[model samples]
Target: MSSPAIAVENLNFSWQPDKKILSHCNLAVPQGEFWMLLGTNGSGKSTLLRILAGLLTADSGTVELIQPVGFVFQNPDHQLVMPTVGADVAFGLVSERLPTPIIQQRVAEALGAVGLSNLARRPIYALSGGQKQRVAIAGAIARHCEVLLLDEPTALLDGDTQLDLVKQVQHLVKSRGMTALWVTHRLDELDFCDGAFLLENGRVVDQGDPQILKHRLQTTTV
Candidate 1:
């Protein structure tokens, strides 16, 4: 059988020597699968994603991943650097010194994937929150990463926009056969995930189908 897209064994992390963030955390995502990470505020969800993305080294434990992972931060502004949408999408390819024709093609395909083809030339500042988020996703798609990691990607959007964006992301993940690990606190968004894991005080306490997990969370909460 194929190896898992991501695997973490006995992971541990802390900001300072005394304050622990994650403790013996373990997770596994199969290739081409999408999983939702559900946790309360300050539960180390973002920290875990950063670790998986190679942004932060864990204090202890192992994190094995398929190479070429794409990370989309909670705030689109953090991922977007170029002025125009198309330019930002092609930024990574440009850094690789890819031929101009290939870069243009990739940028176009990425933008189209995120439904931003028409706004390719639009200035970053002029786009709405949802549009900006799409631009960030397009940049990752342009890189053709094998896995995508998203951290609270819809925290800033309205209800309708959040739903729409999640649907688009879900479509992209399935169509591209890419693994996605999405961190979200919004219970309604769980429906879009193929599986779900719950984190509490930095440990994965429960996991299973999204609906079942949601039910457990609701019934057990005080």
Candidate 2:
């Protein structure tokens, strides 16, 4: 198998001494594949994703992930800063200091990949929840991020839009050869992933085929 694009070894985290969020958690995502993180509320799924994105520090553990990593929060409103779709996508590339031409090319390509090429100039408020998520993804694509960490990205969408967004991410990961780790509670979304990991009590108790995990989740009470 390819070397892991995202890996955590003996990860441990806690908000206070009385409780542990993640306990000796260990998991890995293979290079260029899309994987899902499954867990109930407070399962430390989001916490783990945050640590992988360097947004949070683990109390004890080793996190080795490919860079530059792109993080997509649960709400696009929290990350999309520009007024327009294209501008927002390009905004992420500003830090790289690339030439304007390069930025335009990237923005065009990223938006196109997400099927938002025609909405480049459209106001962010006019877009649907799914579109907003796509625009957020375009931002990462524009930056050419090697690894994508998504924390419940489809949580705010309807059933159709939720599945659509997950499908879009699956396509992006396979087509672009980018590694992605998505945190989701929807079992239907598992059908679109290459694999999945089940996080329980901040520890990974299962990891493997998406269908199997989906089945397990369906039959068990998280």
Candidate 3:
């Protein structure tokens, strides 16, 4: 088996010493596969993703991931800072100081991957919820990120739009050979993932086989 692109070993975290968000949690995702983290609200799903992304620190345990990593927030409005789509994608690459042509090429390719080729010039304000999420993902692709950590990227979208975004992400993962860990509650979304982890009380009690995990969640409240 190939090495995992993302791995966590006994991760633990808490807001207060008594109120734990994660507890000795362990999870892994191999390169080129897409995985989802499932749990009810306040199950520490978002906290775990933040720890993996290095946005937050774990009080105990270790996190290892392939870099450069790209993070898409639950709300695109919070992640997209530029006025337009193409510009926003290019913004993430500015720190690299690449040549103009290289930046443009990367931006174009990323936008194309997310099915937003025509909306590069579109204002961020004019985009639909799903389109905004695509732009956030394009920013990650523009940087050639090997790992993607999405915190419920489709949380704000309607049903059809949610499935569309998930399908597009599945295609991108297989075609680009990238690894993705998505945090979601919608069981239908499981159909697109290679596998999933069931997070309960900050610990992963179940991991593997998306179909099995989906059935588990469907029969019980996540």
- Which of the numbered candidates is closest to the native, going by highest lDDT? 3
Off by over 4 Å in 1: none
lDDT tens digits, residue span 124-161, model 3: 99999999999999999999999999999999999999
Q: Model 1, range 1-222, lDDT digits (tens) per residue?
A: 889899999999999989999999999998998899999998999999999999999999999988788998899988889999998998888768899999999999999999988999999999999999999888889998889999999999999999998999899879999899999999899989899899999999998799999888888884
Q: What alpha-carbon RMSD in Å does predicted model 2 have with respect to the real structure?
A: 1.1
Top candidate when judged by TM-score against the true structure: 3
Q: Which runs in model 2 stand beyond 4 Å of their true positions?
A: none
Per-residue alpha-carbon lDDT of model 2 for 1-222, expressed as tens digits?
A: 778999999999999998999999999999999999999999999999999999999999999998899999999999989999999999998888999999999999999999999999999999988899999999999989999999999999998889889989999999999999999888888888999999999999999999988888788865
C-alpha TM-scores of all predictions: 0.97, 0.97, 0.98
Q: lDDT score, residue 213, model 3? A: 86
Distance from true position, residue 44, model 1, in Å?
0.8
Better of 2 and 3 by lDDT: 3
TM-score: which is higher, 2 or 3? 3
C-alpha RMSD by candidate, in order: 1.0, 1.1, 1.1
List the global CA lDDT of all models.
0.92, 0.94, 0.95
